[model samples]
Target: MIALPFLKSAPPPLQGERLYLRPPQLSDYKAWATLRAQSRDFLVPWEPLWAVDDLERSAFRHRIRHYDEEAAAGTAYPFFLFRNTDSRLIGGITLGNIRRGVGQNGMIGYWVGEPFAGQGYMYEALRLIIPYAFTKLRLHRLEAACIPSNERSIRLLEKAGFQKEGLLRSYLKINGMWQNHLLFSLIEDDRWR
Candidate 1:
C-alpha cells in the first residue's frame, strides 16, 4: 500500500486562474444538489444511472463518506470545482482507481454543470489536477476513458495532451447499458516531450 502523507487531512485546494478544486464538504449539499439537479439532462447520458435518491442530502452524505474512505486508502481524490470569482459550484473532478508501486497511475474523470459547459473550466481543472497527480502524487501515468460518442470529452482529453490508446469494448455501464469507451492516456514522459 502507498503511504499517503495527507491521510490525516484533505489536501489543500488546487487553484487556477479562474477556478479552484477542493474536497467536498457536507455544507455543499445544497449547491451540489442544485447543480446536479439542474444538469441532470446534460449529464445523464454519460454517467451511470442515478439512484432514486441520488440528489438527496442523505445520499450525498454517503457519497462523501465513500470519498473520504477512498482518499484515506490512497485510491482516489475527489473534488468539486468552484468558480474563483463567484464561488459557484460548477462541477466535479476525480483522480480515482489509483495503482501504486509499479503501476503508479490513476484514472481521471469529470463533469461540468450545463451552465459551465463549453466555457473552458473543465480544461483548467484538468491542467491543475494533472500536475498534482504527476508531481505531488508521484504518478507516472494518467488515463481517461469516454464513450465513443462523447465528442467534447474526446476534444478535452486530446487538448490536455492525452493520446488515444484503443477501444475498451463494453467497458462500463452508463445509463443502465454497457457501452464501449475510447481509452486515452498520458505518461509522465509525455509531459516533457
Candidate 2:
C-alpha cells in the first residue's frame, strides 16, 4: 500500500464551470441509482455486466467503502459527477490502478447519465481531471481503454490529448462478453523525455 509521499492526502472536490467532482457518499445512492437505472440501456453496452443487485442500496454502500479504502490507500480516486446548476448527480469517473515511483501512471474510467451524454459534460470533466491527475496526483502518465466500436469515447480521449497506442485483444469482460479494447495514453510534459 505504499504511495508517493505527495499524494498521502485525499483530493478535494474538483470544480468546473458546470459540474463538480467529489467522492461518492452513501447519501448519493438514490440519485446514482436513479440515473443508472434510467440510463441502463445507454450504459450497459460500454460497461461490465451488472450484477442482479447492482443498483441496490446495499451494493452502493459496498462501493462507497471500496472508494474510501482506495482513496485512503492512494490507489484510486473515484468521483461522482454532479451538475452545479441544479446540483443533480449526472455521472461518475475514476482514476484507478494507480502506479507510483518511476511509472507514476494510472487508468481513467468514466460514464455519464444518458440525458447528460452527447453533450460536452464528460469532455469538460476529463479536461479538469487530466490536469489533476498530473498535478495533484503527481502522475506521469494516464491511460484509458475503450472498445473499438465506441467512437464517442475514443474521440473524447483523443480530444483530451491521449494518443492511440495499440489494441488489446480480449482485454476486458464487458457486458457479459470479452471485448477487445483500444489503448490510449497521455504522458506528462517533463516526463516525456
Candidate 3:
C-alpha cells in the first residue's frame, strides 16, 4: 500500500508577477461562486458534473475544508488563482492523485473564468505551480490531461513544457459523460536542463 506523505501546514501562497495561487478560503465564497456562475457554460464541457448546490456558500465551505485536509495529508494541493493587483478570483488549479513511492508523480487540472481565458493568466499560474510541484512537493513527474479538442489547453500545456504523451480512451467522465483525453507530461529532470 502507498503511504501518504504529511505536511505540518498548508503550503504558502505562490506569488507571481501578476497573479497569485492560494488555497480556497471561507472568505472567498462570494467571488468563487460569482465567477463560477458566470463561467458555467464556458467551463462545463471540460469539467465533471456539477452538483445542484455546487456554487452555494455552504458547498464552497465544505470544499475548502476538504481541500485543506487533502493538502495536509499530502494527497493533493489545490489553489485558486487570483490577480495580484485586485485580488480577483480568476480560476483554480490542482495537483492531485499524488503518488510518491515508485512514480513520485501527480496530475494537474485547471480552469479559467471565461473572461480570464486566452489571456495567459493560466500559463503564469502553471509556471508557479510546476516549480512548486517539483522543488517543494518533490514530485518527479507532473501529468495533465485535456480533451483532444481543447486546443487552447493543449497549447497552454505545450507552452509550459508538457509533452503530449498519448490518448486516453474514455479516461474520465466529463460533463457527465465518458470522454477521451490527450495525456501530457513533464519530468523533473527535464524542467531546468
Q: Which residues of candidate 1, in runs, are more than 4 Å off?
A: 1-4
Candidate of highest lDDT: 1
What tens digits encode model 1's per-residue C-alpha lDDT throughout 75-182? 899999999999999999999999888899999999999999999999999999999888888899999999999999999999999999999999999999999999
Candidate 3 has a TM-score of 0.95
Clash pairs, model 1 backbone: none
Tens digit of lDDT per residue, candidate 2, span 1-193? Answer: 5636645566789999999999899999999999999999999999999999999999999999988888888899998899999989999999999987789899999999999998889988888888899887888899999999999999998888889999999999999999999999999883322
Clashes of each: 0, 0, 0
Tens-place lDDT digits, model 3, residues 1-193: 6443445467889999999999888999999999999999999999999999999888988999999888888888999999999999999999999877889999999999999999999999999999999988889999999999999999999999999999999999999999999999999987533
Highest-scoring model, TM-score = 1
TM-score preference between candidates 2 and 3, better one: 3
Which regions of candidate 3 are displaced past 4 Å?
A: 1-6
Model 3 deviation from native, Cα RMSD in Å: 2.0
